[model samples]
Target: MLVSTLLERLQSDPGRPRLTWYGDDGERIELSGAVLANWVAKTTNLLVEEYDVQPGSMVGVNLPVHWRTVTWALASWRVGATVVLLDGAPEDPAAGNLDVVVTDSPDSWTGSSADLVVVSLPMLARRYDGDLPPGAVDAAAAVMTYADQIIYAPEPDPGRPALTGSGVAGAAGNAVVGHDELVPEAGPEEGVRTLVDGRGRAADVLRQLLRVWAAAGSVVLTGPATAAALEADTARRDRLVATEKIERIA
Candidate 1:
């Protein structure tokens, strides 16, 4: 299935912490399997019901490595939209054909013809306080109104591109990976605990998330490469390891 089993597998243990995000801005957001699934479901419903996104639609994500970006990616995948990692500037063919775009900075994409969703960076923000351009959606404000449970869409074409615009060098210059290659079959529920590097490219982060969750694992995602790099700050690393009970770093 093009839709990942990670979210579905999370249902078995709703209370278990599935994703833990430590923001560089001193925000710590933790979501259990149930909570993460709910966010993804709500965002998924919002995309299809409000924006008409479905299978084969290209959804652009031009955001930094954070918890909200993760939710957006999972939601787009659930709705069968191909996720194009814009990272603010996309020099790819797929970027020009996006059906919808989700971005932290709406001003950059305000002129684009594609449907725009301006997401707030803060997790507690129920609305993006900043002014959005005409036709741009206030995702944070509207998301709360969406259904907690997802109204599942039809299965997407597994052979179609699942992710693109990755930094990996290629003939097309946009690193693309198919759904059949990206989404894995459900693996054992070992509930492995690992630390995910949030400093990497969006594609790399997404790939690591898929792998960790496939084993019914939990992840403590470190913030972007900040003043205290994960490698240099042995104290922070040791603290995170001890506090989060990290079994390994991915």
Candidate 2:
């Protein structure tokens, strides 16, 4: 189904629980479907009107495993643009051909193209600079792979605390720490998504996790797995998801 379908559903159900980001430090960031819809609208405007990213154009995303990535990708699809995911490096031919590049860090894109426009995640979140496209509606959201926005929730709490959050500096939205949370020492930006502590088939486990989260949809893994070795698991998972279906969430 189109991405707009999800947005509409979420909008209609403003309180519907859509995205939840949990840190290892037992903290959590919850994004309601309503909020996600608005962000997607803003991101859509930035790509089309401000950057002139035309429909059918390829767009690159290089953000941490956070809601911003998900919203940006959805916005691109709403405009009929193809999302070129570059989780790692070497930059795929598809990504290189992108008309515009939206990333957390503009420096991440080493491509040579006058059309590539990098939209920093921090900029988008902190500032309201992008222009909105005329009559841009999230009609057709882009399909995303599970790892498109890799996420690892803090270890599940034996007893989930009230859906409350603590106030932290530079924290995206409201994130609260609970006794049962994983309390990740790193934030989403640091790229310390999950605790990939042990070795042995970590790649396989990550792949499985991606397939499950992506709703058994198509996915690709770029290169350069940071501290998480996400790239390794992404590669294996892409293949596995292609052959079979796995259902999961982060």
Best by the TM-score measure: 1
Models 1 onward score TM values of 0.91, 0.47
RMSD of 1: 2.6
RMSD in angstroms, candidate 2?
17.9
lDDT of 2 by residue, 24-92 (tens): 233344555566566666666656555665444556654454445566656665565545555544254
CA-lDDT, candidates in order: 0.81, 0.40
For residues 22-109, could you state the per-residue lDDT of candidate 1 as single tens digits? Answer: 8888788899999999999999989989888887999999888888998999888876678888856444455788889998888888
Leading candidate by lDDT: 1
> Which portions of model 2 miss their true places by more than 4 Å?
24-27, 89-91, 114-250
Which ranges in model 1 have alpha carbons more than 4 Å from their true place?
89-94, 168-174, 185-189
